[model samples]
Target: MPFPLYLLAMAVFAMGTSEFMLAGLLPDIASGLDITVGTAGMLTPAFAIGMIVGAPLVAALARNWPSRSSLLGFILVFSAAHAVGAMTTSFPVLFATRVVAALANAGFLAVALTTAATLVSPDKKGRALAVLLSGTTVATIAGVPGGSVLGTLLGWRATFWAVAALCLPAALGILKGIPAGRVKEEATGGPALRTELAQLTRPRLLLVMLLGALVNAATFGSFTFLAPVVTDTAGLGELWISVALVLFGAGSFVGVTVAGRLSDQRPALVLAVGGPLLLIGWPALAILADKPVALLCLVFVQGALSFALGSTLITRVLYEAAEAPTMAGSYATAALNVGAAVGPLIAATTLSTTVGDLGPLWASGLLVAVALLIALPLRAVIAAGRSTEVLP
Candidate 1:
């Protein structure tokens, strides 16, 4: 791996840790702020909303900036937000910090994708993107769990401090590793925001973005409820939640790695084989809800299948929206975050019915079914995209 790529991955790990670690810290934060956990929960959605809305907006505004400066600026803001959040006693202040951090994170992800793509050969772009994305999966496996432990051992505030502390090395690395210069687009004053928006309007681009969103909805939908599923449905202890988290994270890390290796060569074919497997996996998860060992194993399978689909779709988004590299990443970032925001609401609706703990799994299955239906027609487009051949 290039040294610069390592720096990008480290930065992503810090950003990913900051975003996902909030779930574990919510209880402590709520108590400290003298608010209900439910209210504290709003911080997560606020961050999601920031990602959804800020990705395109920030990507466009920073389109003319040097990638190095843009990346470094994003890191500075993210670090400051966490630092402020750590010291704040007010819930609203903390909430604001979450949104600020998310906006910075959203920009970093969008820009990082384009940056990573440029750092490698055309054939190797998929692998490079995967390298950047792997940081997030590793975060799931290590960072989130570590943050939870850190919070438990120290206090939630210390986790915030640790996240901020991670930024120093990453910032230093960025300054040293990434070449300092403006891109061709920046020298040419970049396309108008309208041009970037036009790229998003292309049907092929929209299709890929939607596919990314739907897959994530399925992923986060089921994932959001894993703890309840473990304890309530599977009749396991709280320890099982940690086990499930690790299994799912590990499987996703492996899956993304597999997708990266095959993406440039056989994206559509992977979708064909993996999509049905994913569709089938969900119902099994629901049916085996009461069987602890079975359910836990299936959780790993679900994670692999879903992330394989997700990572492939994201790579496709890059090809489909090749006209606007940075904005393409923004569209991908916004699409995934949109799914993350919407999935739980869909699953939450099912809880009022007889489904109970099965709701999330069944809801995820439905989302996957829809994604397949959408994906079925787009395999040709995905294949066409490889050669810059857009089907009519």
Candidate 2:
């Protein structure tokens, strides 16, 4: 509830809008560049790949910088990239800008998490993170659709310009609000940075990240094509697609808030409940696709449970990597992006096959079940560790 927290959320909202608004702008971009829609679609993966590769590297490179400086620098670069993108007429130029923008996004997100965690008491970390992540959910509900409509009315380039303009205020917020110093690292003495990076290979940590990735894939697999699925299978008009999106976003907002409060005390329980909910929701969605009301209800439930699991997953990862918060945040960002990249690919393949639009629901369900299987063992792992030492 601090002013700086709002600034952090604003930066995330800008980054998230840039990240997701592309989904709506793809056809326009394709037409503008005289490229195929499939080619334009490649920009999404390019951005994801940039995030996956950039976050850890940026965290390592900026390890010694003040958090405020790092945040401001990253967001400035993000704005610059979007400005360049707004002027480019070539597909390659636009694609390259997306990569650059995503790299900046990764850096900003990593620094923001580290900054948020540092600003608040250990007991409040989950709540702070939830506040930051709400930006993304809001962007999904408002920014994406708004960008699409703006592009339709003005131009796709105008949307990029608008995003670029938005970033200036975010950067200014970071400068004015965030403390101008490095975050104090937790004192859990390790060998060195080399040894710390090696902690990434730990079985427990890797398992948590894997769970994060799988959860994302399960959610995004069906979510990527929600517009078409709602209309074609749910038997709804185009108007209802936007309504469904807002409902899902509202549910996500609620889920993150609740998960944040419970995560510090009952993270495992939250994950346990969320994973099964997704597994059940997706399959039920597949069966009830023709029932408009049922489909709407399931979509909201699925979104809520997905974010509940996601926020808890993030809390656990931060706890697991308490010694190296920046890189831990980076790893979390990369893991989510990996799932974001893979989920749509799998969903698209399903949409092309005989199974039709309903295939994504089943695919997402199977992925969630696999994630649950992997996560089930984590409870025992946490219990054994807790028996030895208390976790934050």
- Highest TM-score, which number? 1
Model 1, 52-80: lDDT tens per residue? 99888898888778899999999999999
Model 2 lDDT per residue over 90-128, tens place: 888888999999899998888788778777777677788
Per-prediction TM-score, please?
0.96, 0.94
Clashes (backbone N, CA, C under 3 Å), per candidate, total: 0, 0
For model 2, the stretches where C-alpha displacement exceeds 4 angstroms are 184-191, 382-392
Relative to the true structure, candidate 2 reaches a TM of 0.94
Cα lDDT listed for each candidate? 0.85, 0.82
Cα misplacement distance, residue 174 of candidate 2 (Å)? 0.5
